[model samples]
Target: MSPPLRNDRQLSELNTPQRNRYFYGKLMDVLHFDLEQEYLIAEQRRGNRLLLGPGVVCGLQVTVIRSGGERGLRVGPGLAIDGWGRRILVPDEFELLPLRLTDEDGVPAPDDDGPLPRQLILSLCYRECRSGFEPALVPDPLCDGPAHSEAGRWVETYALHVHEGTAGDVVRECMPELGELLHKGRIQEALCLLAADCPELPADPCVVLANVAVGPRGALTITDCLPRPVAPTNRMLLQLLICLNERIEECCRHDTVLLKVGAVRLLMGNGPDAVLDSPDERRVIPRGREPLGFEAEFTGAPVDQASVVMDSSVEVLRDRTPVTLPVAWPAPQRLRCAVRNALEPGAYTVTLRGEGPAITSAAQPPDDAEPLDGEAGRQWPSGDGTPGGNFVFSFQVDR
Candidate 1:
């Protein structure tokens, strides 16, 4: 038969030997931090459920040797437990050192290195509930006294910041996982976890909407709500989508753009042509006179030689132009030139006159230009010049 479950609170009250040998046993050795370095430990068996908390807390549990000698593992400084139902356990071997490094106003004094007891400084500040044990240790520099104490305090502060930053990053990056928890009907729990782990998130409408949208699917596709036309009115939507996409990409493997783009396209497609004309759409698409030819003038500097290439529908009007050298000493490094092109009703190409570089025209067809479909619309360079930069311009041709 299995041993009876133990309450964490009661376990905390047990003497070092009893807690270590009888309570924890084999379970005590297995606690560890995940890839994020966040602590995870199995503390108590409450009924069939296993309780886990930060490694610092787990380390506080005493360990007893077979000879009955007990040793309490030091709960390293620089660790703190936050969130509801979270508890902190300090080993009987270690005691709290209450030397405040900062002034009463919370500002650091010139002598204030930071928080003391470098190892115990957790990323987050939390309440400490004493188990009514007498203080067994006092705050002192691990090495020498006073002078080194301040330095140690500074080190503690730095370590705490590092720990907190790391935890915050992990929490932010694991949004999808949090969302998954919510999807599994653990909404309140998920939110609580998020709040406890990442309190930096603002309580705003957008955050609420984002949480709801991501919660059920364990993912969020901003493209669904993204406007079709790229305009000022939809700028906020576009920015928000970009930010979300970046966050999702960084934190989880989810690609918001790929998921939502098709849906956005379909939605925009269903709208009337007039809607297409509206500047309020948020999609990333080229607009203007369909496939219209425009001259791109390069004026600031002098170039030894310049060339152009058309990879898309747009064509270069000028076949060749002289490389104008600058007149002054150390003459302007680059030269100004223009690619004038009147493309066929379809996309066309105009290669530059030299061996240097080429620029592709736009993909959009000109207003008066003819329409070419599929491969027929793409303009390729003839086999004369060497390819340097693949500066292929893109444009669209309307029928």
Candidate 2:
């Protein structure tokens, strides 16, 4: 079962003879890439589908044309890639001639509807070629034509695919399987499906070159659309932020208390406590401190109304002893509380804990699947990268 662009190991060897053929005859291998690489590029191109895979390289502009009392289209030269990652090239411009427009005739067809437009679909096409070859033909003395007319190499002209398409149908042709997975919210499964090669992948690759809408009287309307990016883990981030919201009714609510921590860490001593140093968790100054507490950082979405339940959800400990301090939300998306009791500090450990949603993985990943890029996938059991439940972070109060 050879796939598209089959590897033959022989295209690099020689120029094929006219009358005779060998095992090496049809290979199209170049110096940089052998026939094997030719076939293997298919996989490389396939992997890029979700990552800017297919589109026009340059040219291929479709424009409306008018001649006498008739209307048609003029297509410009350009290159593009099909959905299957195959290259489509056009070397010369050509006009696609059509009959007079429905309204142009001054006599509309019996089935003519309103001024709705007609769509034109353009894509890649394949063709065969033949050219003049070796041995010259024997010519009669009276014959005026060339003597070598009998032998010719095969050649063919291939280009645009013209079809009438429905409105907004051009985007629907891309990666239907991946689309289905996304619509179902199976993001990890979609990633795995792309990572692994399976039989469900499409065999015939066809991509849209352009979508042109022709008005009822033959005016061309081309709609240009761009694709946006999708990240697998963006929505799954484990944000531990807590906020408070006040409501006027059941429908409308506004933030009342948004817990925000620090722009800078507050360590002890007076003199306006000037510590001009690079910011980090390690505290340099020794302290019989005035007051102390550390801020917690979180990501993803913030939860509301945490001011009433802050103490139960957050925990702070020095070694094994707990420091009781009232927690409040001064601003949004930051959690903080100050321990008022002054301490004789030599060495201390403060562990901060906050609750977040579950991570991407719950249990052990499938045993058969090998680690990708030498790292476990998101499907693995929750541990480091996957943060869920309550997250723990500790910083030392220095002496």
Candidate 3:
């Protein structure tokens, strides 16, 4: 399938509602989106409501909604995302979405002042955020699972409000302190940074603060609980922010780290270690009456032991008829079995699928290891496990 268009005007011209539809269409086309998975996201059970329009900036990627109360939410022009976090950018106008406050019995939920319901309403006005602009640089949840995007990275979030103030001051104040806390792995300290400097917030209207990182299975859902009038009020806003900070910290922290596989490589029968990197390719199997053997190296968070299952198939390139046989994935260093039957095999393709548990490792790096920098940091596991996914490895076969 052809890739989506990358023109700015083509996308930016649409309002938020339209853009969201476009995003959903692209997600279904490119990422294999499923309604079942959407249900799973809603089932994760946390909600957060972020007002995205003029002056609001969010770096964390997820779905955000507006409180359908009387405050009159607006999507500015286009998403005004910038390098500096404090920019007053405007996104296109989005239509108002309805809020649902009903329980499973279709009855109104009790108003006990606990929190808003996170059950997603199909018609609600919300959009899923991505990492990069234009062609969003986020992993497909369908292909890699939601946990894949955050596999081994630390994630921090904050509540941002658009009001009057220079972006520079806010950036200068928050970035340095937050960066220090992140660098030193001081999670608790980082969550408290915003509250510590509460007195320095830009006068009436502007409010922003940082807090703790989310866990591997962590999910955030934003909702509208506070009244519209309380939004613009300073005293009420501060109280709400304090409450939010405490809640976020409590929800995202955990004892065990989550892990996921980063890469996989396939090598055929004791050859010169030629790697089958592409998803599809052509190869030749010997005409001998023997099975084709192959081994794979699964790289990600190195753990003490892992049990892997492989799904494989060999199909004739011309007619695309799959040749059937008993298949097995070998031990860490052993080859199990290969193709047994050899019909009219001029050229064929073999495809392999890999799946396993979200692998974890408690192994620590050597004390004398070099300081992690740039690519090195990425290569070294952050002592976190990765979520598993079905991976494909394909190559052509010929006699």
Sorting all predicted structures by lDDT, with the top scorer first, yields 2, 3, 1
Minimum summed lDDT over a 10-residue window in model 1 is located at 257-266
Which ranking of candidates, highest TM-score first? 2, 3, 1
lDDT of 3 at 284: 43
lDDT of 3: 0.32
* Candidate 3 Cα misplacement greater than 4 A, ranges: 1-270, 277-291, 301-319, 324-390
Count of residue pairs whose backbone atoms collide, per candidate: 44, 18, 32
- lDDT string, candidate 3, 219-327, tens digits: 2232322111111235546878999999988997644432323323333334453434332323444544222444433333333233322222222232465555444
> Top lDDT: which candidate number?
2
Model 2: residues with Cα > 4 Å off, grouped in runs: 1-57, 67-70, 82-86, 97-124, 133-156, 160-168, 172-189, 195-399
Q: What are the Cα lDDT values of the candidates?
A: 0.26, 0.43, 0.32
lDDT digits (tens) for residues 1-399 of candidate 1: 111222334332222322233345444321221211111212331211222222232222211112233211122332223222233332234321222233322233356444333221122222222233332234235433443321211011111111111111122146787879978998888978755742221121010000001113122122111111111224455788999999988888832110000001101122322212211122222333232232222221222222222322223432232122111212222222222331223332332222222222122232221111111111221121222222223222333
Report the Cα lDDT for residue 371, model 2. 14
